[model samples]
Target: MPYKLSATLSAHSADVRALSSPTNDLILSASRDSTAISWQRATDQPGFVPSNVLRPSSRYVNSITYIPPSADAPKGFVVTGSQDTIVNVFALDKAKDEPDFSLIGHTENVCALNATPNGTIVSGSWDKTAKVWKDFKLAHDLKGHQQSVWAVLAVDEDKVLTGSADKTIKLWQQHKAVHTYNGHQDAVRGLALITDIGFASCSNDSEIRVWTFGGDLVYTLSGHTSFVYSLSVLPNGDIVSGGEDRSVRIWRDGECTQTIVHPAISVWAVSTMPNGDVVSGCSDGIVRVFSTSEDRWASEADLKEYEDKVAGQALQAQQVGDIKKSDLPGPEALQIPGKKPGDVKMVKNGSIVEAHQWDSASGSWQKIGEVVDAVGQDRKQLYQGKEYDYVFDVDIQDGVPALKLPYNITENPYSAAQTFLQNNDLPLTYVDEVVRFIEKNTAGVNIGTGGNEYVDPFTGASRYQASTASTGTAPASAYMDPFTGASRYISGSGSTPSQAPSSAHMDPFTGASRYSGAASVPAPTTNILPVTQCNTFKQANVAAMQSKLHQFNEGLQNEISTSSLAMYPQEVTAIDEIFAYLGQTIATPPQQPSVTLTAAHVEAIIQVLSRWPTSQRFPVIDLSRILTGLCPRVLDAPGLKDRFFEALFKASDWSDPWSPPPPKPRETNILLLLRTLVNSFQERAGLEDGAWPTRVFESLSQAPYAVLTKTQRVALATVLFKFVFSTKPRAPRPF
Candidate 1:
């Protein structure tokens, strides 16, 4: 996992034309994108963009060469060839704005170019000839191949190697063929001089063959699945070749020592630095330098297998029934002695639902289930057929949830009513002190489409409904299909309620309940102390979670500066997003959030959100229902901003505006998006920087804060949090 990616110099507008490694410290690349750029060395930060951009040709530049300038020649000239078929030699020390003279006469595209030690320029062209230039004038036309000469190499003034489409690599001495090797069945694409051996040739036959000056074939190495385009002879006599396979391979003593798959478009050229590392120029308009040091498949297989196993295990566990869906209980519903769940709404947004009694009593979202032992009331059998109107009812169905009513159709006919009973109707007793209020919401109660199981119509939770199942959750194929309005639930069979035998009710299935009697939900926990000064946080939530946060600088002294806390490009961008989501959630929660909300909290949240880009984008396709929802206009957004927007929304109440903070931005949902995108590209494209989308301007520009990853978000939050919470409160402003 410890890999280093260098962006280096990226001024090219097209595929890199050539590459050269004059020293181990620098990487040189010539690109048709109109410039030659250099990278110095490796570091933790991204490499800098090109310090300069230069155009070597008015048209396409085909090849370039560097001659360690000698005593008899000019000190600064670098030779270059073009598709225009002409050769131009320019000064490396000269500024890019000015043009120099040109060496002309090839009537077709120059495919390859090279320079001899003696200041002699050699270029091979599709014109089917190898031309040598001296003093900027064509001196000799080395002709032998019957087809286009594709590559040329000069070992010295007297010897040269020229490969061609004519299916041969010919050794020429003083402009005459000294030897010819023609065993290859396809076009010869490359040639390299072995110092001890005569020459080396690579062909479209996917083979590399070495030969002697006498035309005797020395050895043939084969491994490439496609054309071998370029090769370099090593000091140890090993050979490294680049081919159409997008790979670089090394052969030594008749064996392939290494093969590295790269992301460059077409592995067209290869070069080696003095340190023995390799550099490659590819057709995708890029040049890459890589270190060949570790075992290629060692971590890959282990990592892949590990990931697969983890995924499989998670699939099994998440599939277990988490809840069930059921239809709302009917009027005859009561404290049944035995009843299994039916199709009822149970799990909504991951939380189980509970019913509140319908105290024909206090009108409200009250508890609606049966009560425990009362004054001589055999509550269990006494209310077996009669509905209990004082308490609530609770049931879970098919990994879904629902709340049952307290009053069965018409005051459970089994009850004996007193003449002057208050709104409270528990047969004989009535308590009239507590007044509860409930919003008259008939939305989920109707029989329309049986309440689309896979979607939340009000908050737009259909967005998260993916074609696939959730990770660690059951596969869609394993359960009742929520998308089709169908979810699996259990139905009571073989016996009637109240008569299935009391032994079954003695050890009631849901173990969470500890009360003794006809099952009724114990009252909502008395642990709900009012959240006030007693609930003051150990750490002040000083910073406002939104854009343009107020600073939280007052408490810091010996603290580390967050500027460098986790300076990854990704973490930085996420700092601005987590708060953006928090601001959106307060606008709408599932059900009417608390009645305690005020316009001030609303305005503050809006003000904070306005400083960042909004996430309330338009819904898309059939997937829209789970992924998108109402665009909150409180300077607009939603009630929760987790990466799984739809899933969380279904769990929230559009009426209840309170929501839990999404898992920390640095660890979960928010930064996960950018992390996935970055990781996918790095894998699919190997190590080429050019594969990065130029349209993604921030990353292209090498901005440290452009990544939007998790770690950086945490660090950025540290800083932004201070700024948000540290602002001085202003006096009330006049209208």
Candidate 2:
């Protein structure tokens, strides 16, 4: 028989994001309310009751797991990962607010956690890395993922599996990645290990895939129509998955057997008990359990009330896909039987449109909700190619059309305002105005508790003041770039050309440009200091670069001597991820949860540049130029910046004496190297310490400025201009 609701437990005041069930009698839930609750059922009790609440973090507690009992913690420990980037462990026997052990190593939001039977814990974070903990101490740091690690599973004491927002799964043997499985087109959000098979993964692409340990994809289950966030395996080997579609689906033998819909916006997490019960945490702040045994099912009155809640929701047309109201049949269509369970059918009754779902258990169609037109009702708008919760039109001038400002509810308002200003080439001073406009328009509709304070991770700017008010009065003359802390260039005042730099220029990094008076002082005929703004070579055709890279790889594979130097499988995966990230960021409307490039990706580029033939190295060098411009944090390591630049110099023969009209390959390489250097001047591109920049300048001094081509000279000049303006005072030198 299909599963039916057995119990409903509600104590959280906010969305429940994660759930774990180690036994049939115990359940743990983590919520955005910053608390983790333990629910227990006595032998004579018919339902679970909240037994203890642990305030694990001040921010949202996103993930939770149970560790086996040890001598130190007789009743076992409750582990939690939160948005504050800390993983905390608390003993179940104690009711204190403070944790017994705090495992803090992640630098960003810790979103996933899992533990092995022997008490080894593995955690994944938005920091693009995972960590293993043993006996309350750091065991191994799992690195190499190029994006946020959203899902993690401990296969055993020595093996772990991590799924990432980069749309790939990696199997790690201790701290090293041994195998990468790539098939998902969107973020891989959930994973569950099968007994005999390798594992099953669920993704934002709305597909569940089963894979074997031999790296072969067994089959795919494709009934869910939205992002799948959590997965678990039953003792009988059936797969249970929950998703944004508000449905808990059960898969048996690679096919969807049933879908249990919830009365909430999202079913964020799901787990299976030691027996046969299923547990789910939902966005409605409720934890529900379902069982196949009729004796464990809830009372008839409670089931009816739950059904009414599901039927009361008002679903927009977009949620069910494009609805052609004219083409839909009338009420008579409900008389015909649906082919399978969970099949949705829309019918027009008189002038109203209704949504109905086929229930195999009841052998009838159940009215789930009413479908309404989605113009201004809960449906996301398509801005460029990406979907956004809101797209406002801002009229900057009387005669000009309003510019479109796209935003999502989950994004920080300051970040959205900055993106809007940058996209429209507007002045940074308008940031406050844009933010106020957004707050005024989006008031009361924002999700969660509105007054909670949040700190922007990128800029370290506070989003809300202590009085529960927006921080709109903060200075806007100097705004920091989110990725790089460099001061954004604000537009100059409308004064005469001969006027000195405006005192309104508050950014200490850029005092004033001597070239600010361009009209009064004739343009310099030679390369000079203090250019108005730094010019970066950032534009690129990512598809073309990727195609050329693969072409070169194929060429190397066909040759006898070069075959050994062909890109390694991991290197190829890294390169492909680089292009994917570039494509997403450069799209008309950039994708959310942006991928972060790691030192491993930089290492891959270095390997290709060092090993590929000279003629074939330009494409790789061009890719480096784009990577540095887009993700400068990849060079944040201790010696990675030095090594990366050294590879570029070696690839271009920068140390060799230059002759006029150099070889075509060498000339192309040098030009690309110069362009890459121009892109590397932004903040966090290893400019904190002046040693690397001095080395770069010293290398360029080897080539006489007079002998360089026009393109090379222009690139070199831009690099020098940026270095001079963006950094502290340094001795001047001629190139």
Candidate 3:
């Protein structure tokens, strides 16, 4: 009750994409229009209102997160990821317009970002890569998602869990993706982690999924008809998700058991407060607070004009001639026509429209004024030479006030095509022209698999190119081609196919090339069309079912029903309630596990060690985020996983040191055992010519992890555990 809209902050010129409250009193908001603003709630409102204003950014801020201060004193920091493919960091109290750090190198838009205990930031980009940054410099790039990355959460202090537009979530050990959850059909937008167990996520695919670090599906919660736009896991083990269907649902144990009226209105973000109230920020430029006490789901409106119809129906000797039940307090319930009985959607948005009367006597289709006792929409006649195309909806029905149409008609073929393709994995019916356009406008590309001749889309001249081959790897002369795929080239020549070489002869270094001089770029070919509509529909159903099964796999042992927790209508299962409480409680605690400064964590320390103790000003590189998780995999033998955390807990009092330490020898043995494991991994992944894993690990070990603070150490530990030990495998899609 004491909170009176502490700060009325105007976030952005457009939709606010993300917000992070790093400081208890401050909120940083990022917007779709490529901007970010810092806001503060006044500690004393009697004098000045707490208002947040914009910061400096030329592009829309896609994501913002606060990193906990590393030093003993409080440090005010805000990190933002922008569409410009840069991660910008600001120190709130420092000089105006001064960025403490500006990390770049991502080739596409940065979609998600998170801060770590070490003065480092991790970000996911549309380039299908995740990166770690420290002090305005580049870091190691993590190649994972087949599509754009959408959201990310630090697994501990070091590792990160990234959800992507590719309908998968990857667990990254620092900069290396160690595991992936490829179950959801829709792009993931939000994720919440629970200790070292794994995490939960919401996706545009209309479902919630939970996964362990090992990439195992734990459990799946369902029930949203539209895209799940926002989600928050409550401390009490319940999940609150806001969907495009215009309803906010609460889930406990993975099922939608309750719903709340929320006409969606473009929900951009959702957060669960400690007091159980859920706040949703929408595209309408307004924030709404929904609580349990007023959880009354509105009953369908009983149009008063239908009173006579209801009265007559109640009659017919029903309980002695319509007993006084007719004198109810609510509107007289009416059986609305043109809708199925007992349909919830009927009352939500349904109406009848009367057609213009054809007055034969006047030889004209004239407006007959209006029809009485009918709900209707207004429409207008549009003359199109011969017959009339509808200009707009106009109601001729007499029952009510002014008429209005629910929607307008307009050409949206591209949107329609996108929806169709997404739903059925089909290609556009006709795309030859589109291919030619890309060739003209884009970096002219010529796709080929074998070394041969290809006709240009425009010139119609034969250009030596590789033919589409069975293996994705193209000859030195071809673009990397995957196995047995139909592909399209943005060649200058109109609808012509490239030729394959009669004999296998290709220069290794020269690889593949085309006439206009473009390397064999990734193909734009997909078998979207040609499939039978009925079969495609059936396949779509199978895909959806598979997604559900995959969700079940990721959900593991936990699930939350999609219902309103404030006024839950469904019966609560005995055990689920405990987790619901824990989910909510997680909000209050700092979300990082304990850390132990081990050999692997310190491996990356060499980079900073060369600069030494007081070298706060050192060469900034991508090593920061990469080392936190990657170093452990190479330098430490025992990978970071659930077991690693348990073992680390016994050796450190960094988290909660209420109990006495473990016996001396037991602690020493575990540490030495972990050390030996690290040594073995170092040997396996060292820079020597070996497996790709070894090369990656060796490259990561060249850096040191010692400069990381205790918190950073712990974060690094968690990152390594999630990355090195997670066992989830991502499902790859054929393009």
Q: Highest TM-score: which candidate?
A: 2
Model 2, span 615-718: residue lDDT tens: 78988998988888877777889899999999999998887777776777887788889888877885437677878888888888889776676667767888
Q: What is the lDDT of residue 6 in candidate 1?
A: 24
lDDT of 1 by residue, 1-735 (tens): 111112323455555656666665555566654455544554554333343344666665667776665543344455667666777665555456444658778877676888866677888987667988776677777764556787788878877788887787777676666666779887787888887777888987779998886888899987776668788765556788997554677777776655554443247678876756667776555565554444322245544443343222211111122323244343334233212111111112223233222212112122221211111111111021111322222122222222232322112111212211221111232111010100010001111111111111111112111112111122222222211223222222221122111222222234332333332212332345332221100111112222112211110111133222222334233433333433343344523322222333333323322222122111011011111111122211233222222222222211232233322321232232223223222222211233223323232233244343334344334323322332334453231
| lDDT (Cα, tens digit) per residue for candidate 3, span 1-735 | 111122224434455566665433455666655556655545654112225344546665667787766443255677877757777777665445656667768876677787666666778776666777765465655663545667777666567777877777877665555666779876787888754467889887778888887878889877665567666765567777775444566676665534543322245566665555555554434344444433321112322212222222211111111223323222112232212111121011123211122222223332211112211111112121001111212211122111211111121223422333343223454222222222222222243312322221111222222222221112233312121112322232222333333221222235433223332334445557433321111012223323322222222211122111111112112112322322333334623323333443333223222222121111111122123222334233433322333333233322232233434333332333233233333323322223534433453353345432332333334334433433234453231
Worst ten in a row by lDDT for model 2: 514-523
Best by lDDT: 2
Models 1 onward score TM values of 0.39, 0.65, 0.42
- Report model 1's TM-score to 2 decimal places: 0.39
Per-candidate clashes come to 84, 0, 109
Q: How accurate is candidate 2 locally (lDDT)?
A: 0.77
The 10 consecutive residues of candidate 1 with the worst lDDT sum are: 433-442
